[model samples]
Target: MEQTLRETIRNNPKKILGVNPNDAKVSLSYLTVAFVSLLIGGILGMLQGLERAGLIQLPSWLNYYQVLTAHGLLLLVVFTATFTIGYQYANLSHSFGGLLSKVRKLAWIGFALMLIGVVMVTVMIVLNEASVLYTFYPPLAAHPIFYIGLVFVVLGIWACCFGVFINYRYWRKNHPGQTTPILAFFAMGVFILWFFASIGVTIEVFTLIPWSMGLVETTNVMVGRTLFWWFGHTLVNIWYLVATSAWYVIVPKIIGGRHFSEKLIRLVIILLVILNIPGGFHHQIVDPGISQSVKFLHVFMSLSIAVPSLMTAFAMFFVLERTGRKLGGKGLLGWLKKLPWGDVRFLAPMIAMISFIPGGAGGIVNTSNQLNQVIHNTMWVVGHFHITVGVSVVLTFFGICYWLIPYLSKRQLTPKMNKIGVIQTYVWTVGMALMAGSMHIVGLLGDPRRTSDTTYGGHEIAVSWIPYEMVFAIGATLLLIGVIIQVYAVFNMMFFAPKGHTEFPVAEPEDDATPAPLWTERWGLWIVLLIAVISMAYVVPIVDMILNAPPGSPPIRTW
Candidate 1:
């Protein structure tokens, strides 16, 4: 069996690299990109925080538009994308059977493409030719290279998806009639969503890049916005879905229990894919071009997406509670007392969940048309997203890395440093919360977002909000320190961890008297495809309205 397996793996190099890909090389490469992106993004964030505090004079070269563009692109595209694909490669290798070589090579190709795209985009921005936000929204243009770079990035991501699909096929083939591994399925689901989501962005990149460079007469702003959100909304979901998988896997391990319900987990994955795509329309709520009915429908779908999110939270908490019980914890609050609080793995997830509460609440508020009007383009909006998306989800990613690095390297972390990192993660979470709260309050006071500094109606606003800005800067400093500690931990695990061969724990055999039907074979994906088509149909007319608004009529602005 071993020889057969080795031969099979050698025959298919892509699968081996994909299943048990070498982390020492690829993971570190991706991490290097993430580190640089985070540093740049963090600096920009600090600068924005200082500007909000009114502590420093703004510089001409530190243009708000350019900083904002770079910050968004680096964090959203570079940091999140690189970390996720890297994690997926690592997780899929361990979770799915053993390593397959062919899949790993495909992953390498994907990584190369990602690096190429990043370099291309970075050069354009440095040259002052592509200051357009990562959105690359139409009417506002950039060098054609920016769009080309993005295409290369997407192509690389698509190649990564292919690697994921091949492994899924192998798993199914080997483990006939077994329910797909939950984490593996979720990873594949993200890719499926991404594949469809990229269609719109692909269209924009191909059509608009040449047009923006004056190779064509013009491009439609309305069409571009519509397409971008199709990619944008799902893009966020791509990251969140991966974060959710981490939560599902790591939370159980932290609490010392198995998942609550595999079926429910599957349901959550399906629902996310279903609800996320249609809900992209909500981003257009402020635009006049979309019809009220269609907008309302999107709002409804967006609300529906929250259902799975809540369900996931429940699933996690319920499992944790059970684990606590099994470990001999006594009462309602006893589980809290019994948990291994000193374990960074345990503390990290706990902190992540806590941060999620305010973030999720803020998201619901921000997505509401009436509430969004009050905070739109304000510091509060920035705070809200950073907390929900940045702190909650990304922190969870950090937690997973902390937990997995030691295991993968066959070593234990510097416990003292790990503990410090956990504490810092908590501090950062609270700091983000405080920052978001202050921003929300100031937003209610009518402070705009993405501005280096602003004066309303030629009168400078009172500096009463200075305290919040100060608090935010302090938080940023602490957050940076915490991230640095984490990097230190990862490095130590890679270099100093015990050097020895270790075998993965074997899954116990289950007694199965009867064979099961294939879920994939039984359910045709046509229904899902139909839903996607309908979603696009719903969005097309909204674009028309935005593009053909009557002259002299102000663009529709919703609350």
Candidate 2:
């Protein structure tokens, strides 16, 4: 009787109309927070660039590290976190027809908690009580309220994660024989990763709270750092997974092509989730306390992530070529000319994919023990993430905004708006290239990062870095322009654009594609495997750090 009712409700004509307006409010609210963060973060980023170029001096009330901390926190944490929640919830709503009312309430509750957290953290930063950079690595402590703010944020994320799980369970029970929509599957992967990846950081933050309150005298820096990166590097892959979802499901639709094998895509998601957390160990390669042999092992574990990445690259290229050929291109390379280069939907993510080539290569260098020694502490490291996250992940997010905002708002993507987006994409690409390229080169020339001034009394080598620093300022200026355009475009589309329908743009698989095995849906088995992998990678080193611990350091404020 319940099954029959579920089927009837699912097939109702009104259910297929569009996203539930109530659900759209949840997503749009999160997106609003996201773009607002982007605007502020972008401004902070430009200030850092100008300061690094020695073009402007900040007032006494604000220091370089404060700006750095705020910039990283806003864009990296708040912006990305809010955007992912907003976007993924929309995916869940679309895939399941509509979210459960309870789930919608959870979304709003999560939003409120996160907003509270962001407010607290921002206040601490403003008061200069927390300039602890985004990583918030320990011994360098912030006010206890900063850690408390982070707790609220994590709690908020947990709320959303539970909501997704509930929705997934409900859908599976209703449609026993069917695979969940590909986007929902991706959403499951995203929130699952989110829930688990945050565990280490939650533990870290709980420890920090007491020490920051002077309840504990000292905290172990090694343990704190280990815990942080366990979450930190996984956060990187979480964004990658989010971007990959679009590449696999949405981009193909935009390009008029079928998605690659469903089985392969699911396999990729599983592999990424299991292999991801261990890869964070590589970020700690330069730090001591971990044995050299373990670090060497972690190098391989980190590189293991590249296998699925390569598979994705291959699959995407295959889809693009096949689609272009179908659109009537004669020669081997001529298919490239047949793509929709003018479409912002395709153009932004295509460039994002292209940027990952260099980004991925740089990652390989960062992972290698010998190679990492040279650049680990340099601006090259910053440049690497700038291209990886800044372009690859962020540009994809920018592309998503064009269709998603309009769809949620029941508005059209006007030609004029599309042109603005296209120009914004180019401007951002050029800006990131100039800034990241110069950072990489100057890093190789031995320019250090996190230091406000490297002039060294105008030494010859330092003097040489001035030109590259100037380029950084110029790139930052253009990026600010891009940010202004993007934020303006988002609000305009959400509010003022003409009323019309927009498609969600999920691609279908090829006709002859093999059915994805039901075994892939065994999320329990996958989670077990993920835990096992994490244990193998972390247990030994963490045990060593705890057992052979030094008397830890007390809180110290550098600023």
Candidate 3:
């Protein structure tokens, strides 16, 4: 009987057993770091908001720019990256029955390298030795160590990327004539984008290292800025793609319904992967040296991303509507009422999906050439980012947490904790609404971003911005409260939840639906196309920036 049980467990590891304890530990450790970073970054965000509103004066030992730099790095790079790795690895492990031992080792190595890099970067930020902000844009150089730390971060990401590749190759070789599992497919798309996205930034950083060390007198600012945005803007979509994975596969299961057409889903993923990198050009729309024709062509490339986005939106809606109607929901709008609104697992992501309506519209505005010029450097762009990332992406991540953490920890989410999560979601939504909303209004009034002070010696126009700034302070306070509650909930779920079996929540397709075609798995062809598209959009402008470059500037430390 014991031998029979062992064989059963081996045959159905994910179901009969659960996530391997070793594998669970790897994911949990990464998540712990992610949430901790969120806590610190949240505090810094609150400080920046209050200081910007003139509600408090910062001490000499710390400055607003320093806080800004740390906040961006902690939340954007550390928090997001760690969370993504943790979640994706969990998906990979569960979908493939279990991760290989070697893949597990690579994950641990990746974690250690990331920790070392984060420490180096954080220490520099705390000591005020590096305040160049998250973009690390050239001409405003940071400490050489800061740049070196970033190199480590990239290396860590690459290690994980290679681990995914090896595991994927092994899976395909072992199971020929079968399509990859859907969740695993999404994971591949994610790491593929991650690996390619880092390439430009990696090159830019290598150049900066020697320049920051004074081994070179100057470095090309345009090239550096372009490279950073190549990674930076694509980073936003990487988050979007991660969120969509949940929307596609996880949410349907939560609602007791099947997913949309597998073919359509794969097509969306393929389109996104092929067209994403070139979309970064819009970030550089206003910069010089790039010709108008190039910018015009890039505007189209930037807008092309919306096709996949719209495809995602449509697919999700179809699933929601179908599920609702099947559950006996009636009327044109009654299907909405059938959703599991009381479940935090559903509520958080529901709001996230809804928030994207306006968030996506805001994105279209930012991508338009003339429209971008109007709000390019204003608080409006900040507001747009907050709404899109804070609500759409982070909230989706929050939703995943309620289930994912419990699943990995071998615990069940209690009702009381669900209530707390629901409350946290609403609090975050309202806070972001107030904060991001006011920012948009004030930005249109000409309030600039990235400035420590916009008072302009109390000029009437500047004075007019004060009331909105105060709104920012209030919204920020609420957001901090939300952050604290969320951190508490994550830890509680991780270590203290009731011991029980929790489902991994993967959805299946309808019985009658067609299987996803094998052609969709042609990743090599997709990658070659990605390279071609990137070349078409970047080659002319980037070559112009490098070959006809201006006299490069020395490091200028503003703060």
Candidate 4:
């Protein structure tokens, strides 16, 4: 009787939606941390942007690199990751019918580990002992505790991943012949990718921790950089995975359209497994230590990544077109006019997709050794990153947060709040256009990235960069405003809003009657493919590094 009743409620689109509050303790805890991280990171980002603009000098107590480190860690690592895990937990809970009772211990323990790590790392950074910047590249070594803290955080998140996998494994056992729910399937695929991705950072952690403690005299720069990129690029890709899942699943419903082809979506997931790791070679395209043949192999692989992206574009745009037509759109291009402009839910993701066109193009260019010469370390790369992770992933996550949190907290998002959300997204898009556009142009004119010190000791070329930097600062101010608005809405809803229900935007596929292939649920096959591809891409390069490595360098303390 309970199972039959559950099936009835779960299948019904018209019924009240969202995960039960009792089932969302873990996600709520994570959302708290994630939102706070956004505030801290966003504020630091604004200061850094202003500093770069030369409008104001930084205070004596803090330097630009220190601020940069804090901003990157808080936004890129903490906010993006915590929010992804939180949302995925909520997603899995809804899919599994409720929180699996056995995983409660897993949730609390993982949260504890992450909290402790955050505190430790935050203290280290505040003391200015760990200003190595986010990448923590050696000989730019941070303190020992900072590295230890990073290990703790990664372990905590990995533990949560294990718990999710275990629960899903049990569910499959009990419910034979049933395919995993779509979100759950997406989560599992990402979980697999992240686990593989984690190996690189974990290896770095093991090496860095001991080295920081003086157990090792020197560390290999090539090895550290190679491992870092191995994890680094994939870390961003993990964010993409989380955001893309929502794009495929949630945005369609927001636009009043049915979901696109599950078969194609599944293929996209599979392609991610085969492509994401090997294609990370694009990150190291400018490094000369690796041979041209290896770089060429990765460039070819990098170009192949576009195939999956195009596939995604096709699937998403097709549904969007359908949604436009359903909303009374007509003609070949008329459907474009019919999209939900005022709704933040639809606008944010739509804007994200629009930004991705140029962002993805920049990525491909960076893969080319010759083309990368112009933009490799320039603000162009920064502009590209802002468009991809900054606008595309960041805005979409903001949109998800606006709705997802309200649903989980069982709080109604008032009409006023929704309007604010819409405004914030649009404001952000405009801000990014100004900042990123100028950044690209300035980069082509030879502006470097990663340093606040744009002045070349009164070099004539420095004068040319001032206007672009000023534009970036102005854009940053507007972007900060958007961040403030989002945080206000989210905090108000989570803590102080009246108790009320909100609908879960789970779009039923256009062809719900057609079953997804059984293999779509076979995560094991995807894992095998991922392993083979990673081995082919990494083993030779890593081995080459080990064989030809020079004596490693001693750690440097910038402070």
Task: Encode model 3's per-residue lDDT on 150-267: one tens digit a residue.
Answer: 9999999988998898888888898888899999999999999999999999999999999999999999999999999889989999899999999999999999999999999999
Best by lDDT: 2
lDDT of 2 by residue, 202-303 (tens): 999999999999999999999999999999999999999999999999999999999999999999999998889988888888887888999999999999
- RMSD, each candidate, Å? 4.7, 2.1, 1.4, 2.0
CA lDDT, every model vs. true structure: 0.69, 0.93, 0.92, 0.84
Tens digits of lDDT, candidate 1, 483-528: 6666666666656756544332212211332222346332237336
Off by over 4 Å in 3: 1-8
For model 4, name the residue pairs that clash. none
- Residue 362: error of model 3 in Å? 0.7
- Residue 101 alpha-carbon offset, candidate 2, angstroms: 0.9
TM-score for predicted model 4 compared with the true structure: 0.96
Specify the poorest-scoring 10-residue window by lDDT in model 3.
7-16
The most accurate candidate by TM-score is 3
Candidate 1's C-alpha runs over 4 A off are: 1-24, 57-59, 457-465, 496-559
Please give each candidate's TM-score: 0.87, 0.98, 0.98, 0.96
Give residue 55's lDDT in candidate 3 (0 to 100).
87
lDDT of 4: 0.84
